[model samples]
Target: MQQEFLPQMSSATAFIDLSGLVNLFDFETKAAQAMSNLAYEYVVSGAADELTLRWNRQALDNLKLNQTVLTDVTKPDTRVTLFGHELLYPILIAPTAYHGIMHPEAELATARGASAASATYVVSSFTTTPLEKIADTATQPLWFQLYVRDDREFTKDLVQKAQALGFQALCVTVDTPVGGVRNREQRINFGLPADVVAPYMLAPGPQKNPLTWKDIEWLQSLVDIPVLVKGIMNPNDAELAIQAGVSGVIVSNHGGRNLDTVPATIEVLPYIAERINGRVPVLMDGGIRRGTDVVKAIALGAKAVLIGKPICYGLACAGAPGVARVLTILREELELAMILLGKASVPAIDRSVLWEKPDN
Candidate 1:
């Protein structure tokens, strides 16, 4: 199957310009044409068997929405304030590694695009560009995603650099103790370029003592900015993050790239949100492609939704403009969803908008 796709890509030369694309799926199709086979799979594929990958979409599709009529929504507001920064919408660009694979501009283009859309960009630790450059280039809010190195001093230096550069928050990725078994990458023997490095990393792979709850506490102590722990799935873990002094929790399964067969981020979302019980903001990623998905997430108690693949697809298709278009489409979709559902503002969304599908 992979071989067939590669051959088809040989005739995929004429790039699909932004004007020709209408949705994320369209962008993804065009991107597949634009990128090399290995690069495309690395950005898009999930873990072994990809069951959780399929389930992430299935869970969102399984849920139903309850609409209200006869309520005034003359001016529906999609604005949100996250960690003291106000965003035009609740959609954030998820921190995916190696944007350079998709476009020449890489993280710089993404930062510019996100800033153009008035959205937040969570710059990945495994970035192709330097951290300070992205921070300096970004006009919108920037948050640094930390993958602590084996050396404690190196980790502290990275944290302090982010703080010094005016990064608003620290997003500690907690799931990747060791890299997951990405079967697609294995099949293609995918590896990073020799030039791409973490810049601050003192070692090659995951650190020896992969962060614990104590590490979370220690991370918080190192910086004055809000710290959000990403890669949480279980309610117990979410509770533990709060106890560890995290400012927020991102309920993700590493975009279905880690520990296959775990419940979809959407499947575990409400549970984690319920357990957190308003103690802190709960954001989620994985299988979020539509604006309605954003609305459903907020109704289920997500303060916002982080998007990964769509951003990749957008970059692949038309570079920075493609990414900005992706955000525009989703934002429009969310605002429309809100207005149609009689939600006047982000604060008006709640579980009341959700309908449980009847047991068969």
Candidate 2:
């Protein structure tokens, strides 16, 4: 009773005219028009009532920026360094599943686009393309997003494989023990097309086990590469992850796809960052649509921010070029935001950039 999602165009003819797309939302608008109903729903849908999904953007919108005047802002720097790798901008591509559903080149196209924009690309564990192939295509620093399986050996082997593949970091996702109740996808009976399968999943029997801090500790023991724990929203959990020896923490709510009614990642980011107290780097995702959002995240405490749906939308519109253009737009927007705020560098952003209402 499941419906399979497939795009109409072949990879060779997948290119769409991206001339009119000016921003991320423009890509979203175009992507919705270009993609099949099932594919678009899969990209945009969140869990249950989707309150958290809506709040992600709403909470960011509620935050007001306080700009300064009469400061020399001739040069604006958007560079950020994470785990020793310097990114041209603070924006990174969040790991998302089933890129093949959006475009024919799949993760290869995403990798090329991220590399073209000089941004870090995180490959999802549920990637349609093989990790080795993605690594081969990516010119920028690559990080592998891990969803630990019930089988400990399988999880261990996957970690080793990613390390061997030259992935710079292992981003272990710890939030999704079970799938979310996404009504939209459920309404469509969404299922992947036959040709699009996660190559790493071919070996594991089935992942039934939820990840634990102990598992994260074990993962750290396996390889010398830095292991980051993604899906952290609670401050206590962020503290625990650092104690467990994680190199970094990514504050996320699974893009509001895993749990409904949870606070937006942006809302909880400051608490997590405060708890970490600069002991380790903090990154966040969800509800980042503009350069101001990136600046807001940096000001609050995020070392960098990852974007999910926008990248998929870009891929759906015009393959690699669309993806690159999305990143470029965000970078330029962030640069402009920084210049207007009279902040010359990424590190110059702080709580002072935020406006607080006066008490009566």
Candidate 3:
């Protein structure tokens, strides 16, 4: 039997501290109170008009789960294998930068929280904490989210370092050719505190030079572990990713930050999943707010889902414990949904779970 990994929070609780939180949004609300206005905005805001950002959540809401009772779900299993390690659930902590802005412990706290929850933590290239330090703190699987710098050699060096430090995989972020203009962030003059540092920088600044397919090939040539290309949103792109020999695809729109009006991650997931056709693992992240949301993504054929802003929200609320509480809530909700829907395991969730398919 797989070890029980869900945080035990069924006991009586009052709304006093992080333990009082019941859901991801609850953490988000608490985080807003704990963090500065600028910090909160930076974590939550989307690019340009913010239409895509709002749409991410709206798209998930549009999907309704069809419930089926009178079935035995007493032992419904939530375990899933990704990159050769079994996770307690399909929800992963997406790579968001600069945890220090949310809490003093920074990425280290996030790493510890993820391990406690038995979920994968993809450390961002822009992490305020050193990767080695985060690696030491992690008890579960750790993957590095890479943003290729202008200096190809430096980027390669970072890749080597991550592998040496025991990162299980490399999730290369490809959507950001350039930074998006988040009006909310600009209005606040948002910036990381001076003490926060990106440990992987050769020369600190923005990495504005665009990367091509050749870069992916070079990255793969350097690392023995799986290299999953993040930021894929189109079927054609998914096809290219397969041809390029990537181990997986994360169907993301950079959490609606890189471009406005792009299709929601959920909206584009099925098409990409079809194109990949099980050739590689297809994961997604954008508007995952509930356990039902996780069910919908898996039903549409996502191997797993990554979470970004919510982890920041949890970090800001109460460091590692807050993050664990948020994951516990999500895991419990997913299990409840699974049992209610008559699914025996993660594999039992499919397109049949959806009440009706929304028009693409």
TM per candidate comes to 0.92, 0.94, 0.93
lDDT, each prediction: 0.84, 0.88, 0.86
Number of the predicted model whose lDDT against the real structure is largest: 2
lDDT of 1 by residue, 15-47 (tens): 544667776778888889888887799988999
By lDDT rank, best first, the candidates go 2, 3, 1
Question: What's the lDDT for residue 18 in model 2?
Answer: 64
10-33: candidate 3 lDDT, tens digit per residue: 222123376467789888888888
Q: Which sections of candidate 3 miss by over 4 Å?
A: 1-16, 201-209, 357-360
Residue-level lDDT of model 2, residues 1-360, one tens digit each, is: 111122233455455666688889999999998788888999999999999999999999999999899899967978888888888789999999989999888898888888877788989998999888988888888898998877788778888999998899989998887788889998999988888887776443435565779889999999989999999989999989988989999999999998999999999999999999999999999999999999999999999999999999988887787788898888888988998999999999999999998696
Worst 10 residues of 2 by lDDT: 1-10
lDDT of 3 at 74: 73
Positional deviation of residue 236's Cα in model 2 after best superposition, in angstroms = 0.9
Q: Which run of 10 residues does model 3 get worst, by summed lDDT?
A: 7-16
lDDT of 1: 0.84
Per-residue error (Å), model 2, residue 314: 0.3
TM-score of 3: 0.93
What value does the lDDT take at residue 100 in candidate 1? 77
